[model samples]
Target: MMSNRWLILADDLTGAADCAIAFGRRGLAAAVTWDVTTSGDVSPDDSRPLPVLAYDADSRGLSASDAAERHRGLLERWLEPDRVLFKKIDSTLRGQPAAETAATMAYLMERTGAAFGICAPAFPATGRTTLAGHVHVAGRPLEDAEVWRRDHTYASANLGFVLGTAEIETTLVPLSAIRSSDLASRLARIAEGGPGVAICDAETDGDLARIAAASLAVAPVPFFIGSAGLAHALADTLAPAPTGAVHIPPSRSGSLIVVGSLAAASRAAMRRLAAQDHVVHLPVSPDTLLGDLAGRADLAARVAAVIAAGDDALVEIAIGDALDMSLGPRLARALAEALDPIATRIGAVAATGGETAAALLARFGIDGIRLVDEIEPGVSLGLTLGRLSIPVATKAGAFGDAESLIRISERLRAVRTQGSFS
Candidate 1:
């Protein structure tokens, strides 16, 4: 069978790239675009429609109503009958997932006559799983996870409760039904009634695979609501097709590594990466970035000098104990502005946070990313599409290990040297 065309919608840049990379790895051309207001913004190329197109609504940090409106507007313009919808949410239940899902369901119902959502946000490879309708990260409930403590929109980790905030009717499909022989029938029964979501339980890749298969077999073809793990499961069920090849940009200079996430995993990875002999760590305080233009310029110059010297430059925002989450976007924009001058001096770019990656790419005049491969479980490697067509790797704030940044840096360098992932 020919591969299905997908319209994957994510709330952030990293989520968009990672989920789209699932199909990209399956040999389908996948592209991710952010800040999309017009239909033309999502086009990967003028030649043809891509097999998988993931659009980042950039709504993760927005309020519930605003996030819902964003998703509705995008779907209004881009939701086609032939294209399958995959609503990508954070695995750890961050951002405005409840609002987003409700918006998606309402739109799909209005447009397609019926709609049902299949939510399975478990990414086993990254140590995230859903059991009893609650998301677990590395064997701990999402409520107890560091990411939730740092940032959360819900009172509980239960998927049902989260979805309930938006008044979305959800059915919890336990592990028993997921592992049973008549899984498809069970899903069909749940989706039989008018618009409702089913929160499926999954502990491993195999369970996710089963969920994907059963959901596909059901009527109305329920729109997916999950993370990259579910996207991977869906991609695995589809037969591989030879699509257009991704263009790999040539290496120009040393790679630029930017980490703007406050997650402990990202901070640890940044430290490990900075320890490399060929890497120079350029740490700037949030205060300096937000206020001191001269300091920002000097930091940019230092970054350029490091790249000119054939050494990797690692740019990180120094966070203090009294830091507020509300300052994240301003800090990200400031950091991006500081480094915008050195865009031409870098060969490849690796960013750790979603907002950070989006800001830097926008500042550097990048329209979108054409995903090519996954460097690790949650890290995606792609080539930027506009003024700067260079290798860009993105990782979520809470994903990956201490050595993840090092591995990503090496991957970008290798791609620069080889001209292709092959």
Candidate 2:
């Protein structure tokens, strides 16, 4: 058996939830936590010796050097003999992936005599793939995607160049080689020889599975890196057993869908959800919530009233002409303050954007989340842990299509808000 206690470290909340949910689905008691001390929280019911622990470093918005330093420190503390470490990076290659992954590799090498990182950042469910070291989206190079053009700091989509510039020694495992059965031996040799990073190519979910199985076939398992796809594969190979049934209580109130993302996919989904007849739309200006106390109060009351009326409500931050990136944290805090008073009345929540979800959970005093299911490719549906235990659906800002929000709202309503109203 390839059983090992798993520790997943991610840059943001959604990444943390999605990656952790992989293990959760495979019968390992898994929880996602964001702690100032970098320590993780376990579920109250979990008594397993090595319950899966996924931590969000919240370093997506930090500088490369700062992010790298944070990961190095975290790795030093999380290193354990019985634990398997997996660094979770965005499937689309967002954030300071190069810096973070390199830092993880460096720290692992120092802690263990021999360490090799096998990184395959492909999540086929969401149309992300790697071919010949270059990351692509929907068959096009990532540079052509809207997200890359608007927010990317990298000059190219090639993982080699990205990691190379960060001074991380990496070798590419191409598609042809990845499909071969000898991959396990190949990876094992790299792990025993010296410190090196293997950036594997994966265009489909099967590729990720093969890579994961091959990597595990080795004696000393290599440190894995990727998104939910790789995490799911690892869980399948190691924790392949059905623990039991997951009980989710039905909700007596309508669900709340919160949108704090400015990404095009999120904005489009927001609009689609607003058009639904069963859903009520409540738009709050980010500036008004952050600056005007009266405006914030009025908006909160309106949102609360809508939820109280047995109708699903879509609360979104209206994007205007310009977005002030510096006010991001402040806006999240302000929104959380406005919504905190009525959180209990809202049965379930579907939040888009990581910072938004993190802020709201923190305001509610939630320390961790026990993941239960994935509504879709990137949407993680789970129950909060600690202070509150309401159902939550977390989605990354740049993921999903135009109708994603509507689908999520309907699912939450069915699972939580629908028949319980009686």
Candidate 3:
């Protein structure tokens, strides 16, 4: 039997939750935790080891060297002989994926004397695909996507080129080979050649499944690298027995919807959600959040009142004509600080963007999230495991459509009414 132990390392909170929830949906107990220090909280329930534990290094906004170091530190502390490691990278290749992948490979080589990586960063369900080694978003090359134009560390969308930036050797496994019957043997042969990363080409979930099976068949169990789509494929390969039941806490109050993502998808979702009669839209200007404490307090009070009256509160950061990507983290922190006073009044929460989710949960004193179910292809639902225990739905900034936020808010409300998710 394959070892059930698995560890997923991600650069941000949403990546960790979405990847971890892939296993959770397979009936395996999974949890996501961040801010992992030597003595920091590691899991929701440490008494019994979870089958899957995803940790966010919170390095998405860090410099390349800092991001690499953060990943290395986590691996040194959390990696174990019994656990399989899945290094999660942004589907759009937004952050320092090359630095982090190189760091991970170096650590594994040092520990086991042999380390091979099989990277398939395609998440076809969300329109992210890799063809001829270049990443595409919704039929457009990544370079042409809004996300890449707004923020990108690489000059090209080619996977090999991205990995080469860190001087890490790579072999491109074309889609033709991935679809062949002898794919397992081909991948095995590639691994036998020595320590290097295989950048696989995948344009669909079936392609990713083939890659997952082939990678697992290789000796030494190569570490997997990808987004939630690849993680879902791996989880299917493991096929752990599902747990019997899940306990979801009851709630009588309204849900809190926070939007701090700059993605056009999230902004559209917020707009659709605000159209609902029971949701009170509360928009906060970036300048007010950063400079006006009185204004921030007033917004928080309005949010509390709206929730107190059994209505969902939608809090969003107002975007202007041109906003700097660098202001994301600072704006997220400011939003979190503004909402801190109303934490206890919130029955459930739905947050967009990793930084926004992480900041709010941290400010609310949450240490971890015990993943229960996936709300959508890339949206994860969990129960916060510290200071306050409540159902929280998290989504990557660019993963969903206009109705995504509406579905999440309704799901949280339904869970609260039913008093359980399972």
Best by TM-score: 3
My TM-score estimates for the predictions, one after another, are: 0.97, 0.94, 0.97
Report, for every candidate in turn, its global Cα lDDT versus the true structure.
Answer: 0.88, 0.82, 0.89
Off by over 4 Å in 2: 36-42, 418-422
Candidate 2 residue lDDT tens string, 1-422:
46657888899999999998888777777878886542443354755454688888888889999999998887777656777888998877778998998788777766766667888999888889999999998899999997787677578889899888788788888999999979888777766667778889999889998998888766666788899889888888874656665556666677888898878889998998899987899888877887898898887788788878768878888866378766777888899999888877887888999998999888978778877778888888877776677778999988899999988887778767442211
Task: Please identify which of the two predictions, 1 or 2, would achieve the higher TM-score against the true structure.
Answer: 1
The superposed Cα distance between candidate 2 and the true structure at residue 134, in angstroms, equals 0.7
Q: Candidate 1: where are CA atoms >4 Å away?
A: 1-3, 35-45, 243-249
Residue pairs that clash (backbone atoms under 3 angstroms), model 2: none
lDDT of 3 by residue, 254-290 (tens): 8999999889999999999999988999999999999
Best by lDDT: 3
Clashing pairs in 1: none
Select the stronger candidate by TM-score from 1 and 3.
3
Worst 10 residues of 3 by lDDT: 35-44
Off by over 4 Å in 3: 37-43
